[model samples]
Target: MAEKAEDTGVIAWLVETVKTVFWALVIAGIFRTVLFQPFWIPSGSMKDTLLIGDFLFVNKMAYGYSYASCPSIRIARLGVDIGADDFCGFIEDREERFFGADPERGDIVVFRHPVDGRDFIKRLIGVPGDRIQMQDGLLYINDAPVQVAPVGTFDEVWERQGPLGNTPSCSNGPVGPGSICQKERFIETLPNGVSHAILNVGDRPGDNTGVFTVPEGQFFFMGDNRDNSVDSRFLQANRGVGFVERKDIVGRADRVMFSSAGRSMFAFWTWRSDRFFKALD
Candidate 1:
C-alpha cells in the first residue's frame, strides 16, 4: 500500500507538470499573436536608422490583425455563392479583414513583400493618392521638397572578421580594403514633423526618378540609406518591392530592443550596449 501510494503521487506530479507546460504554451501563443512579435534586422537597407543586428519588438496590434498575422488554420468554406465570382475569387476577397487605424506616413513598418510574400521593413514614404518623386537624391512629395538638412559625416571601422561579414563602411560611395569610408549624413523631416537620419552615398540609379503616384489603398516605402536601398523606387516587375497593399502591413517598429555586432552569439563584447532600448524616430 505504501509503494502504490508513492506511485500515485508521482503520476499526479507528472500530470500537473504537463498541464502547466501546456497552458504556458497556449498563453504565449495567444500573447504573440495578439500583441507583439520580435524581429531582427538582417540587412543595412535602413542603415543608420536601423542597423544589421538590431532586434526589435514589432507591435502586432498596431494596425490590427488579419489572416496574414494569424497562424494557419483550416476552415471550411461556408459563404453562399452569390454568382458574382468564382470560389477562389471569393476566398481571396475575404482573406484580409483588417481592424484598427491605418498606418501613417514616416512610420517605420514591417509588411509582407507583395511579390514573394517575404517580410520586409521600411519607412512609409507615400500614402494613398500622394505623388512622390526623387530628384538628385532629394525626396519630393506632392511637388514639395521635404526638409533635408546636412547633419555630419558618418565613419566607422570596418572589421573584416565580424560575424556580420564585411560591413559596408562606405556610405553611397565606394570602399577599399583596410580603409575608413566616410559618408555624409543628413536629417530628413517628414511633413508630419517626424525627422530621422539618412545616409547619402552620392548619386545612384535611384537618385533621379520619374513621378510616382501612389495608388489608392496602397502605400510607398523607402529605405533611409538612399543609394543603397531597393525600396519602391524599382518596379515589382523588375524584381523590386513596389507599392504595398494595406493588408500586407504587419505593424510599426517602435524601438530597438537590442543590438549585436558580433558574428557569434557567444561574443558578448560585440554587443552594442548603447543601442539597447533605443526608441525609433
Candidate 2:
C-alpha cells in the first residue's frame, strides 16, 4: 500500500510539472506575439541614431495590431525560422489592420519587408501622397528642402562592429584599426518639427535621387546614415527594401533597453551604460 502511494505521488508531481511548463510557454507566446518584441540593431546603416548591437523592445501596440504584429522568429545560429504570416496569414489577405492607425512621420519603425519576410527598421521619411527626393545629399520633401544644420562630426573606433564584424566607413578614409573614424553629423528637422541626428559618410549614388512619390497606403523610410543605407531610395529588388505597406509595419521603436559594443551581449564589460533605457527621438 505504501509503494502504491509513492507511485501516485510521483505521477502527480510529473503532471504538475508539465502543466506549469505548458502555462509558462503559453503566457510567453502571448507576451511576445501581442505585447512587445525584442530587436537588435545588426548594422550601421542608422549610424549615430542606432548602432550595431543596440537592443530594444518594439512597442507592438503603438499602431495597433496587424498581421505583421505576429512575431517572425528566426535565429540563424539555431536554424530556426517561423514567419509572421505562419501565425496570422489568413487575415493578411484582407489587407486590414485590427484597430489600425497610421504611423507618424519621423517615427522610428520596424516593419517586415514586403518582398521578403525579414524585418527592417528605419526612420519613417514620407507618408502617402508625399514626394521625397535627395538632391546633392540634401533631403527635399514636397519640393522644399528640409532644415539641416551641421552639428559636429561623429567619431568612433575604426574596428569591426557587431557579430558581422563589419567595418565602419569614414569621411577621413582608410583609417587604421583602433583609430578614430569620423563621419559628418547633422541635425535634420522634418516638416512636423521632429528633429534627429543624421550621419554622412561622403557621397554615394543615393546622394542624388529623382523625386519618388510615395504610393497610396504605402510609406517611405530611410536610414540616418546617408551613403550606406539600402532603403526606399533603392527598388525592392536584389534584397533592397522599397516602399513598405501599412500592413507590413510591425511596431515603433521607442527606447533602447540595453546595448553592448562587443560582439556578444554576455560580455558584461562591453555594456554601454550610457545607452541603457535610452529614448529615441
* Candidate number achieving the greatest TM-score relative to the actual structure: 2
Residues 103-178 of candidate 2 have per-residue lDDT tens digits of 9999999999888788899999999999999999999999999999999999999999999999999998989999
For candidate 1, write residues 1-281 as lDDT tens digits.
99999999999999999999999999987876678777778777898898877889889888886644643222227643221122122333453545756789999998877766557899999999999999988999999999999989877665553444746747635666657777789999999998999988877889999999999878999999887787899999988898988877778899998888877646789899999999999
Model 2 worst lDDT window (10 residues): 90-99
Which residue pairs show collisions in model 2?
none
- Candidate 2: segments with Cα more than 4 A from true spot: none
Error of 2 at 249 (Å): 0.2
Model 1 residue 234 distance off true place after TM-score fit, in angstroms: 1.4
Q: Candidate 1: TM-score?
A: 0.85
Score candidate 2 by lDDT: 0.93
